[model samples]
Target chain A: MTDSINATGADGGLGGFFQNLTDSIISQIPFWQDVLLPALWDGLWVTMQLVVMTAPLGFLLGLLIAVSRVYGSAPVKWLAQLYVIFFRGCPLLVLLFILYFGLPSVGIVLGSFMSALVGFILCNSAYNSEYLRGALQSIKRGQLLAARSLGMTKMQGVMYVVVPQALRRALPGVSNEFIYLIKYSSLAYVVAVIELTGAAKIIASKYFMYFEAFAAVGIFYLVIVTIATIGIHRLEMKYAIPGVSGAVGKVSKGH
Target chain B: MFESISAVTNSAGYLLEGVGVTLLLVGLSLLIGFVCGIILTLGQVYGPRFARWFVGIYVWFFRGLPNIVLLFLFYFALFPFMGLDLPAFGVAVVVLGLRSAAYQSQIFRGAIQSLSEGQMLAARSLGMTKWQAIRSIILPQSLRLSLPGWANEYPVLLTDSSVAYVIGVAELLTRTSQVISRTGEPMILYLTCAIVFILLNYGGMMIIQYVEKKVRIPGFGNNEAECL
Candidate 1:
């Protein structure tokens, strides 16, 4: 494809090289407009839907698990702790395969989308809970004790005094996990859900233009991640209560 | 599930071989990532303004894209077009390593930054060149501080190595699926696969923790030590 352009650039200087590269890229604009843009637009909608549906559910599940781990009675605490370990230990793609592929054998089949949704929520919440747990632990014991001494029930004290501050402190780590969710949500494709990466794969193989297709897809992912990160930063700043320090040194990363 | 026990047993050798390949992928990539990470960290930390900007963009580009897409880009397109014919496994290793380097640099940067400025100055005052100062003073402490975060890259990379399965690399997950199709017992087989991964996960962490204690300077690391 660019071999001809490369041959011409070989005889020319850097300016000519850049010119040829731009010329080739500019020539492809019509094809990208007519072909890649429309398919990618639809796939993006599916991806956005996945993020919108999963984020809150995962965060809510995360809060429950974190709370239970920090405050629940014996068995409940152990179970919640175990849940975090189990899901966090499992690779999300394999978990998706098990849910989407293996579940039929147990006579509980979920659609591809549902399977991905369940898998992501499980994995996402586990990591989120880890962050939440740290935040919960970082809350001063005096706050909870004070709330209880004020005639507040254990649940009421935790709900009112401890959790709000902890969530604020954990906001950075939680939002970091949120960004990981968006990137890895591309894994949904392995189970046959045609989201963003899946759409790119389909188009690449169809057109036999692997480079163009994947490069364009990379741009799509990069743009969305950039936007999401900026948005999260804004939200984090807005919620930054003056005294609650978002702790440093938390290892919030993704595979 | 019971009958398929033999199938797994028979391919226990195959599966072990798969585990070896998986380890090789993670091992080699992490090694490469570690090397690249150090360079990128130095670039960001001590290099000029342009270098910092370049490192910033590199990290953003690699970290922001999904692993699978990076695999697709390099494997299907970039490598072949450039006329180098690395196997899917090699390409996977390289992509994973380079992507990992971005994450690793940040880990190293954080570690390097955590050291007091006085240490660098002390090394400089002792007639040490910048490289000598870094090698003798900066790296010793920062690498230790960087361990927990750096060790974390193991599990992350281990899980991500599964993405190489998409390229048909005959890794553990690929072998597991092959055995799954043969045995027709997805639950047992997949569960087995999950257990193996979890074992691999903590097992690696155990070694890392051992090294952490082994190399730990007395009265060093963690917040309490930082105040001193």
Candidate 2:
């Protein structure tokens, strides 16, 4: 896209070469205004808000559902199962549409951003509950017996004994779901919530620079996921139970 | 309400066509993803370090990026940059397939890892090569074991294929949007679309469950708790 004398371009040496390259790329495209700097910055902020707002809330909702499904009475368990089935089976985009478009027909209205958040919260909670349910199942039955023997109430035992351990065991799976939440948050853009992917689309269509725009967006996600992966690994180590798979080899004592 | 019902019925042909496209996307992508997944699993588990690193990056990118972003990237940028100019349907298949491969590879890798190492060792001591052991001994069992996890991928890809509509792939969601624009009854149309997806998902899961039950090993992987 650029036509110039390459030999004459970087007269200032190695530093000049990079500088010229940056200048050429900038000149060739309105990189800052359209693609790279401000666009991604604003998009990143929105994306952060989406993840930050959704992750904890979703996890708590999921934890509640998981607990209910595992520990609730017959009617409660059936209700939980139905909720999981509906949310889990419906595609996120379709759910967003139903929330944003379908709900308004019934006198319930949500703005575009709120609609996305609600949909994501529902979807996330379903999957998160599945993960937590697995963790709950893995715990031994004796745990509840011990808590009861210790005179703790049913809620107290679940809260003080069972949940802490289940949470630790569930950390890896929960983090995996959190990573999924990060990616699916991009779907918010579908309902006109200008998150990262939405911003890239706007810029890409505006400038016809799909490669640069999406590539930058891709890099942004890659960095976030990579960091999350490492963080999850560290958390696993920190919280690893002695006999669990992720724990280091047990120490030995010599006579 | 009557007009809305008639509108949906009138557009039923178009919606069915969209369903066909959606199924084609899911089917072809699953096939491609399965093959690539096998190759990736072997590479990550049995191949050299460099091969593992390459597959690692492949999985990382595809898994990390949202489906819509990847759809746009392939449909708009990468294919055009390479001068491929492939059809939207084909592009959707490849992108979705590759993304599925990333997840599928992990599923396979887990299955392969669960196979007892002594099986391969015994095969090799019986004069079979590594590849032969993998082909004859390991893969047969692991592939069966992988079926349960792989079955879960169906619903995942089914949901993900909805993103292909963003690139004008004319899938179910896209058709519903078109129908909505025409009928001005988004509630009914979108709910219909949702019900269709739920039906498709549950139907696929039922088939997978049948296969899983028929082929399941008696002592291992039968416990629903561990399978999860």
Candidate 3:
């Protein structure tokens, strides 16, 4: 009934035909106008915060763990290994549930956002550590020896000579991990953080505009990922070492 | 501790059923991914410019977006728009599989790239067509090379399957959440789910690692293999 009426309203004009089509499509997904889009923007903001906070902290933790694993005493190595295994083996959702829901049972209560952050940091750090460890190991022993010959102690050798090169080599992998964080940060919604995906789910259900709502969310992620991909490419070129095979090679080595 | 054990026992059947769903989801998706991934890899490596561009855009969208968002998009939007009334389980499998295809394609592309171009040239010189060269010469070695990296995907897919719970796929995480709600034992239930997932993660990885070991050419790419 409404379809024919709208078609007739087009008045045999091309402009009206396109306008009619747009209006009909928009009418069916009316929630797009006042509700879901705004919710998604808010969710995008939360997602951004999660990624920003988690990236630096996670990278720092990963670097510490990796260094300890590579150069620490036996106990330190054992502890770092355990941390990596535990965090890496656990599914992120389960880890988040443990942090947000389970911990309160044992008198450690974290709010949803904090729980999501902690879970992300732990998981992110463990994976990042793996990459860093691989990079650390790939550095030639001659570099360390050269540092030692220069009157530097083992710690200083690592800190000055080894770590700089390792970090430089590790940039590609680290940035790849950061891109993953941008996507995985959507899981924050599971713990009630109301990030982008969560916002889409709520609006989709509330307004039954599943197609438009989720499509908009997908666009948001696509935009972030495009930016990340370009940024990572630039970083790879900037940090590229002659004869090192560059970003894709180094990053893929992490996996 | 005894009470916690009892709670686990009480829900053991449901949890096992959940594991079945998880495996079903993972297995089907991995199958779909393997098929689609190969096509995508081939497209990127040897196809014409248009095909390569198509593959690039497909991989970019699938890889760039979050799995959860992709899952939601498929489960809620795409299928419904297409007038398909598939169950949540079906939607989960398709979404995970397609998303995985993107990553798997990259893995396969790397493996294919590691191969020397001489193989294809040799195949062509031997009077083989381009398609024949790919099928006979290029694929076997690259497929073998892809195994080690491909094995890594198992754990990744397993971890990602937990997100299916958002759409009520009744997987392991969903089952554990249900048990927690009923028994008010979030810690034990959640821990049990974690242990199960970890077991799957490590166990699956170990099996794939074994396959990799069997298929590996000893001196072909040992340095790279060890680094990975």
Candidate 4:
């Protein structure tokens, strides 16, 4: 066990605890500067790379699956449903292990990074399809009927009318998936891809400074998610209809 | 590969032993989480402002943080500071249980909030104390509403129990990995683990469906009908 000092005082407690905590944090700075800092940099790069590559691909694939499930012919719809259930029911880690290990056996060898990317995209697509499907379903049937009555073909109606509304509605959920994707990308480390958590584990093991290493990782995630939240908020505001602002404001206030 | 399958067949008892530990971790953690969830849900629904704030912070921290990171912190960082030297399994149970509790609280809170205010008011009007009203009325209704969500949470917990591998808990995933490393047939071993997880999730969902069907009030067949 370590020292159990009560840094907080009964009266005027702020200064003492602040100083002690500051000292504790500062004492760990060298460890970070030498080892953990570099690992963090590498981890951040890998995580960002995964996010940038996977988000759009996964989103588009999910959109397709959602559309197929909702608007496609019977066979297509069944296939989409099966895809969603199979991927959604299983964990991402298992999916990753299967892709990384199982594929190589059948003469389908893939590089580690590619395997991780494919696994992530597949899993994310399934989860995203569920969200997008719900969003798509939420669009009033009357809206689609109106587009159809306006001389638009089924594809044209969906592309021009249904999709825009569904996309707007799906933004919040997609943003949630994006945040989850960032965290889930850490699982890539199990396959020896040195993402943020993996980097932290390595540094922590090497330096025996688990506190500083993990705290740094947490801060990185918090900052990224906060930025993402603010960015998505702005996007929501920009696309929101003028009259809908009042409704959105009321709903948010209720929450 | 054939040899490895033969090995598995011969060591079926040993493999079962490992599965037992995995189930133990999942079962114990889920049980602890359910109990903690109920308490936290009550706190959120009826407790003072400070209690609500505390519970809010707890849920935010647990949900936002990665479980593996938290497990590491609990095992390597927090345990030493707390002056307790718990074993790997103990650490896995506490960490997973606490994390699951945070998630379960949200589920329970959502279920409780879905109940109409009129029901609580009616119960109180009937001369019931606040706790009495909650115990006699709210809890039963909330439990019913929460079952489906709780069912989903079970599979989530099962999937996440793999995090116990980080702390050397020797769960299914860890054992599978160990077997693969030794036998060099990663495909077979890992695939087996994945199939097992899929079956577990499907089985859990089936059980939830059964429970929901059995306990559903007469004429309230659909979930939304019950909610209404």
Q: Please give each candidate's TM-score.
A: 0.94, 0.90, 0.92, 0.86
* Chain A TM-scores, candidates in order: 0.91, 0.84, 0.86, 0.85
What is candidate 4's lDDT per residue for B73-124, written digit by digit as tens? Answer: 7888667544578999999999888888988888789888989999899999
Q: After superposition, how far is residue B106 of candidate 3 from its true place, in Å?
A: 1.4
How far out, in Å, is residue A124 in model 2?
0.5
lDDT of 2 at A194: 93
Docking class of 2: acceptable
Better candidate by TM-score, 1 or 4: 1
Best candidate according to lDDT: 1
* lDDT of candidates 1 onward, in order: 0.87, 0.83, 0.84, 0.77
**Per-model DockQ:** 0.53, 0.38, 0.53, 0.29
Return the number of clashes found in candidate 3. Answer: 0
Per-residue lDDT of model 2, residues B105-194, tens digit only: 998998899988999999999999999999999998888877766777888889888888788889999999998887788888888898
lDDT of 3 by residue, A154-180 (tens): 999999878877887778778888888
CAPRI class assigned to model 4: acceptable
Best by TM-score: 1
- Residue B113 in candidate 4, Cα distance off native in Å: 2.2
Error of 3 at A178 (Å): 0.6
lDDT of 3 at B213: 75
**lDDT by residue (tens digit), candidate 1, B1-228:** 558787678879988999999999999999999999999999999999999999999999999999999999999977765556899999999999999999999999999999999999999999999999999899989988988788889889998999888898888999999988876888777878888988898788788777777888778876321100
